[model samples]
Target: MAGNPVVTDWTTDFDHTDKAWAADPYPIMDELRDTCPVAHSDRFGGAWLPTRHEDVSAIANDTEHFTSRSIVVSEHRPPMELAPEGIAPPISSDPPFHAQARRMLLPVFSPQTIDKLEPSTRAYCQELLAALQGKDVVDAAADYAAHIPVRVIANMLGLPEEDGDKFRGFVLHVLEGVALPLEERIVGFQQLFEYLMPQINDRVANPKDDLISFLLASELDGKPLDPFHVVRTVALLLIAGIDTTWSAIGASIWHLAKSPTDLKRLVNEPELMPTAIEELLRAYAPVTMARLVKEDFEFQGCPMKAEDWVLLSFPAANRDPAFFENPDEVILDRSPNRHAAFGLGIHRCAGSHLARMEMRVALEEWVKVYPDFSLEDAGAVRWSGGQVRGPRVLPIQVGP
Candidate 1:
């Protein structure tokens, strides 16, 4: 965040980590979607930005031209051979093997499984809200939104809930620290696996009723999963699960705090909560996934070179006018909406069900407790840089 150069032209020399992009990328994306839908940049060892929904979907579905070898766009690309089971399983894995890896994890994220987590997730949301009581103004993001997923994921991974701070540190370094020096970044990544190794080893010796243990007991290709595979998958769960959902929840609360009409509607018509949640997700979709060009080829008039980074902007796609009605507007009851907030194609977020449940419960609890809230200082609300965007420092007045 500190060392990245300022972006001169979003279309040509784009840097997703730039302050302007993080503050408000919709305008930037809208411009690109119209003028240069497949914008190219030389940064991050060359990268492409496709703001159109169709292009994003095409590239996401086309595994032959792009590989998930390195989902994060940075100076250091993971080796080409890492594919089929990239650093992380499923999300980072490519086809054939991607299907097998993804299929194995499907049972863990099935709706039935997530439904079982809702009660505790809701209770955790209530617990967070309880702490905000009697305060005129509160940091909605730090105090409420950020903690929900941390607790939920910690419980799932069989880790100590109090280690939320550590988890946050890991997420930040992995997601937002893309521009850091390669050596420093490597050390940061090592720390995460180092922390998880003991937990994984403990599960191996004394298996428990958690995801780590489940993976250990599980088989891949008719053989037990390797220890490192278990570690990488667990790392994926920790990193992916916390950051994206936290952003979604925080962004939703940020929206409600500013839009009284929408807030009042959800409060008055409780049944609209489900529909409204999707609307929020579409309007403020947080994640932008990255892929490496498999080989040099032309795409939508652009000559993409092999190993070039392609940032599949799901947030931008969700706002493409070609795909949705009044793409820029947030219509709570927008039924038949097919926004790709979770993502498109094979690598779509696996924990989407759990994410939705977290967002719904978090919003419901917040609104139930503080029905009338507004942005305390719009200027003070800080949005995170890099792929995932959200209100990281949202301050809201508790009541009207």
Candidate 2:
């Protein structure tokens, strides 16, 4: 993969997991969108990569053709086999089943629920910002952005608030630990699940108001949720909960910190914070979903075979000029912004409201305190590769 040519055309065997590709994917995404709107890769058995906005959206919404049963087609991890009956819900199940699983979890993330959670979320943001006041240096990714979502979500799920940093470490290990030996990656997953089982057991015994407890007590498909299903859903939350929002928050702040003009505009006209967050999400989306081709299909002139993996790049789709004006530019108030940063269709992020609130509050708080910060050194930053991508370390100088 190191020797793979710079993505110049559709024929180029693009391995997105390659470090060089990870360092800067937009160029590759652009070339892929231009040349190989639907690309086939030799990796992961075989995959179809679609970068065009319309193509990705149409495919995502066309679930009858593609299924989310195997959303991860990792170069590092082994390909997962789908069970005859889907393993869990929402993420792994297609509609009817997907809707049932999604519906079971909807109340926890409803607009009203997220709005109710905002007051605590805001206070936590303020506490973090206030603690950084006297520091001349801050690692935005670690010292700041990383902690926000972990703490907020951990509390929301009735996990130990003090365990936030510990959970973040577990998440980083699994998400980026693929860079380590395969055994090490497995160990990370083991550590996460071992840590979780006790909580799941405790929830079953006590039946509290937390997410794990709620799942333990809740019914599914006209039956009480299976213990395995409850654990798997909580595990999914552990995986999805930590890094996606953390990456978006870190990436958006990193974008502003690097650009004084953009940072200042947001600082001066804070009302645009809402729109700015949306633009930032579009420009720096942190998640790309993969789907398994349910059957052979020819659409957009690309023939995909069943069992082929397809990466639906929301990041790439947001940058597609067909849907966005000046797709490359992060206009603070880009209205009518129809970006799929939270994804599209039935599999859209369930926690979109909470994620949006967290992003805006993070920027608002940081701008008030450290709008003038800059990177410690350009090379001080490092991006991680794998499904969830963002700056793993964002060292910044707040003042002299």
Candidate 3:
């Protein structure tokens, strides 16, 4: 990553993994939205970044032109035969198949279902805070924000909470390992499957009240789901479910750490939590999805080819001046906030309800305890370097 070439022109050549983009992509995205609107790059085996909300929404909704076969943009492209079901369903599923796959899990992540987990989620947050009692400064990203979703999702999947380190390793390899060598990446996938196959087998043999067992018992077209399908879906639940929410929580904390006024308002105005959560999600939205161009075609005058990667940036779309009022400013109670933080179209995040619950509870409990805190070292805060972006090393000063 260090030796990668510097970007001379954002319109002609842009690299999401580049240090500049990783550190602060807002400016780059804003400039792209103004000038190019649709920026292309040779990196990641040729990819395009559509900065405008209209284009992003169009591409996201047009399954006929784009394929979800491989959502994460990387050097490696999945074989053509993998489609219809893709590597993971329903995120990776396409068209009619995607609908069925997604419908099966709706009840699992429904509002009612996620609400039941709130008590335990709050308990865990309190436990985490309890452990940090004497700390004057803390790494919020690593110490606090990162653990909530991992614990919640781990519990949902019936995996041991102590196996969190392993889950983080798999998440890093899958989401942030875009620039990794193909062979190395394959090994990462192999390692994840190796670790999961055993758990999956155990669930198959002995059913439980968790997602894995639920998937194992599920059927498609009146036939039981395949073992590989179960593994892929579980991996999706564990990887996507954990990283996106973790990043959202960390980014929200990072914003409060820097903006004392916003932090103070949140502490004093307890009723503003719901609106504040949506505003934060709109402004610092994480998880930029990828879609492989279905076939060679021109979109908004840019020549695209089959198998090309489209970096569908919900973050960029959320900030587009054409969409939101004074988009850059984080207004806590911005009304009509129908932003695509959870994405747009049929692929809108199924885990959004769960993510919202986690963030609200996490922030509520955090501000209730440490109502006044600031960044310990602005320079020391480190952000992740791939599609899913957030503060990975956020040091906050909690006491004088």
Candidate 4:
């Protein structure tokens, strides 16, 4: 196969899935962006790389042109029947269908609804921070970052507080990818499915004042949602909402720990939390890729066939010079910051408002109280998985 015309030092055989690659992708992405804006890599068994801001944005927004149906990496694509993410297009479903599925959960995640949850969100953040008081060093990932989102989701779903730990464990295992054995991952998925089934049944039998109940009660096109669809929808929310927010939280903590000045700034100007949230997302850019492809045309001179996958590199896009001035620097008060951290277009993250509220509350509270915290050891900050970017262990030494 021919290399991308724009690529100068293209190597299609490079393994993007290598452990080292996951550990620090920015350097490689930088190289790719500069030398090969549209390179192809055989790492995931052949996938095109579009590193420039315009290319990534175009692919992300033009769903009609670039269909979001198949896997970007051929090797990672699961069998059509067995793939949960692949089934029925769901978020990726074009237009009317996408809108329908999205609407199912939109009310629960609307900005007004998310704002109503702020008090509880702030309370949870304070509780987490309180537990860390007087500790010289604590793993932020395990102790603080990971717990908040899972707890919020569990509570929202009306699951018992006691079940949050178990649910979180299962979700973490599933996200660990190759770190956990294949059989263990399968078991985790099965456990998650089994765990939710009873809740689904209960919601159906006796609807409550919770998200699950709402889903059970709500109808699409004058008919109640199918049970399987309910399960899949809930599963999608559980996985996407929990992991992405968790990673963002962990990464934000890491960034702050690494920069005491930034921490101090946020502590002083609490209103800057919103802008800080966007900046954190821009710098870290947690979710790496969004898969899509053209249905019937060429994009940027590249002819894309039906079912061919094109990956939108948001992290790379956020850093592209064409979009943000001083893209690498963290400007806490950055306005007009339209970065697609949550994503763009119809499939943008449904729970983003809640996610931002969670992050803002967590940051505002944590920094205000623990302004003196710092990473216990820079080298000890290791991440758990590739698909998700987060510190596995973020030990911090905080003042009382």
lDDT of 4: 0.72
Tell me which residue pairs clash in candidate 3: none
lDDT to native, each model: 0.92, 0.79, 0.93, 0.72
**Model 3 CA lDDT for position 136:** 96
| Cα lDDT tens digits for candidate 3, 1-400 | 5335888899988988888888999999999999999999988889999999999999999999999999998889999999899998999999889998999988999999999999999999999999999999988999998999999999999999999999999999998888888889999999999999999999989999999999989998899989899999999999998879988999999999889999988888989999999999999999899999999999999999999999999999999999999999988878989889999999999999999999999999988889999999999998897789999999999989
Clashes of each: 0, 0, 0, 4
What is model 4's C-alpha RMSD?
A: 4.4
Across residues 143-259, which tens digit of lDDT does each residue of candidate 4 receive? Answer: 888888888888888888777677666656655443344465568778888988998998889988988888887787789888777776677677777778888988898888989
Candidate 2, residue 394: the lDDT equals 92
Quote the lDDT for 31 in model 1: 95
TM-score of each: 0.99, 0.92, 0.99, 0.88
lDDT of 1: 0.92
What would the per-residue lDDT of candidate 2 be over residues 148-253, giving only the tens digit for each residue?
Answer: 8888788777889898867888877755653465577678778877888898888888888788888887888689998877776777776777898999999987
User: Model 2, 351: alpha-carbon shift in Å?
Assistant: 0.9
Q: lDDT score, residue 133, model 2?
A: 79
How much is the lDDT of residue 128 in candidate 4?
87
CA RMSD for every model?
Answer: 0.8, 2.6, 0.8, 4.4
Single out the weakest 10-residue window by summed lDDT for candidate 3.
Answer: 1-10
